[model samples]
Target chain A: AQSVSQHNHHVILSEAASLELGCNYSYGGTVNLFWYVQYPGQHLQLLLKYFSGDPLVKGIKGFEAEFIKSKFSFNLRKPSVQWSDTAEYFCAVANSGYSTLTFGKGTMLLVSP
Target chain B: DVKVTQSSRYLVKRTGEKVFLECVQDMDHENMFWYRQDPGLGLRLIYFSYDVKMKEKGDIPEGYSVSREKKERFSLILESASTNQTSMYLCASSLFVRTGRFGQPQHFGDGTRLSIL
Candidate 1:
């Protein structure tokens, strides 16, 4: 059974502050990683994904994630976050070639201006 | 735009009632999935269908069943709705890749918030 863990349940930051959300998974085999965001009153949307090749993957809205296989971690980061970046972020994992995704408990981010 | 449309945005039902949640996708995706989202539980998959008559149980499928009679529509059924089953349900769809080497992100609907009393 594969599971994803997000260390942060809630995070509060001022505008223009840097952001990093920790995500770790329990899987020994090859895996595909993803970060999804849910804005208030909106459905979940893909933020970024890591399949192969580059460990650092850049996604929409100035979001990026790094796949660190050794640590079994894929952490999302932003150099500076805006008030509009506040949302619920989820980390997900899937086995190679499998479409079923295991998602972690989401992290709620509140950016204050 | 890829569109996944759920039949209802909010529903209220009673215990022991049979409930049906409908989902339709216009992207012609090959995979459709139903998930229940709770505050602390995130999103747990209930059922998925890869093809028009092929369905698979997901993480939490004990109290639910699925129907995919058509390519674009996938339905989730709760035979006897319980008070504990009240939660937000989301429908998603994605393209089926033969190789499965690359990851395909699922597109989601606005979600149906069901309340069982």
Candidate 2:
């Protein structure tokens, strides 16, 4: 069984502020990581994913995430965030040879204009 | 773009009633998933179907069952709805890659917010 942990429960930021959300997973085997964002009154959309190879992956809307294997972490980062970036971010992890993904408690990010 | 459409955006039902949530995908994806989203819990997988007439129990499947009679339709059924089952239910679909772990970037539906009173 695998579990995902999102360090922050809620985050508030001003427009153009830098954003970083910590995510860690507990799994010993090969794992796939993903970041999904859910905007208000919208469906969950894939922000980015890490399958293998390069650790840093870029996603839509200038969002990026780094997969640190040693730390079992995949953190989402953005140099400058806008009001539109306000959404609930979820970190999900799926182990190799499995068909299910485990999601964290999610972090609610509110960006003030 | 792939489109996963859930039948109802908001549903209200009473306890002990049978509930069914419908989902349809236009991409003809081989994999379909049903999940429940709560306030703190991001999303918990309740069921998954890889192919027609093939279903698998996910992390939390004690009270939920899934049906996949066709390639594009997946239904989540609650035998006896309970108050705890009141949450936002999401449907997702993705192509099945033989070489991949599960699937890439699953396309999600707008979700159905069910309230069991």
Candidate 3:
């Protein structure tokens, strides 16, 4: 079955530190990928999405994710973390004809001030 | 701005009781979905509707049913609530098209944290 996997369950980083969250999926065909973030007491918000075209996609709040088809990976990264960046991040994949997404376990990113 | 609204922010109910969770989207989106967000489990889709009166079972739709009588509203129903069903429920909506913007990015509600005792 098609599924998404987020390798990091929780990560802690000091302010200004570079951050990377790993995500991988098991699917044989073309797919759409997405990254969503949920801050404390807030709803899930889209960070970035990759449907087609270039493998590198940039999203809101200076976050970006690169889709590597060979590795079945779509990893999220940020050059420098801020205290406000602390939140839970999720990686999701969608089947070609499906509107619903299959999400990974999610990574809780804690950016210490 | 597009908005998805869930009826309740938090709810508590007794086991075996019938429960209704309502979601409304103002964007006139073609697709509406219900998902449960649990710690360590991410978001698992429960049900989704593509059009009025049409519904499809998602990955984990065993304990839930959905209603989409109107274009803007989607309701998730639990025939009999169970403790194992306690989790945060989220509502989302997206538009459907073909080509360039084939699919609208999904917009999510704040979510309803349901606790069954």
Measured by TM-score, the strongest candidate is 1
RMSD of each: 1.1, 1.1, 1.6
DockQ of each: 0.65, 0.67, 0.54
What residue runs in model 2 are displaced by over 4 Å at the alpha carbon?
Answer: none
Q: Rank the candidates by lDDT, best first.
A: 1, 2, 3
Question: How high is the DockQ of candidate 2?
Answer: 0.67
lDDT of 2 by residue, B75-98 (tens): 999999999999999999987877
- For lDDT, the strongest prediction is 1
A27, model 1: CA deviation in Å? 0.5
Candidate 2 lDDT, tens digit per residue, A9-112?
99999999999999999886688889999999999999999999999999999999999999999999999999999999999987777767788999999999
Q: lDDT by residue for model 3 over B1-117, one digit each (tens)?
A: 999999999999999999999999999898999999999988988998889999999889998998999999999999999999999999999887554333447899999999999
Better of 1 and 2 by DockQ: 2
Error of 2 at A65 (Å): 0.6
- Residue clash pairs of candidate 1: none
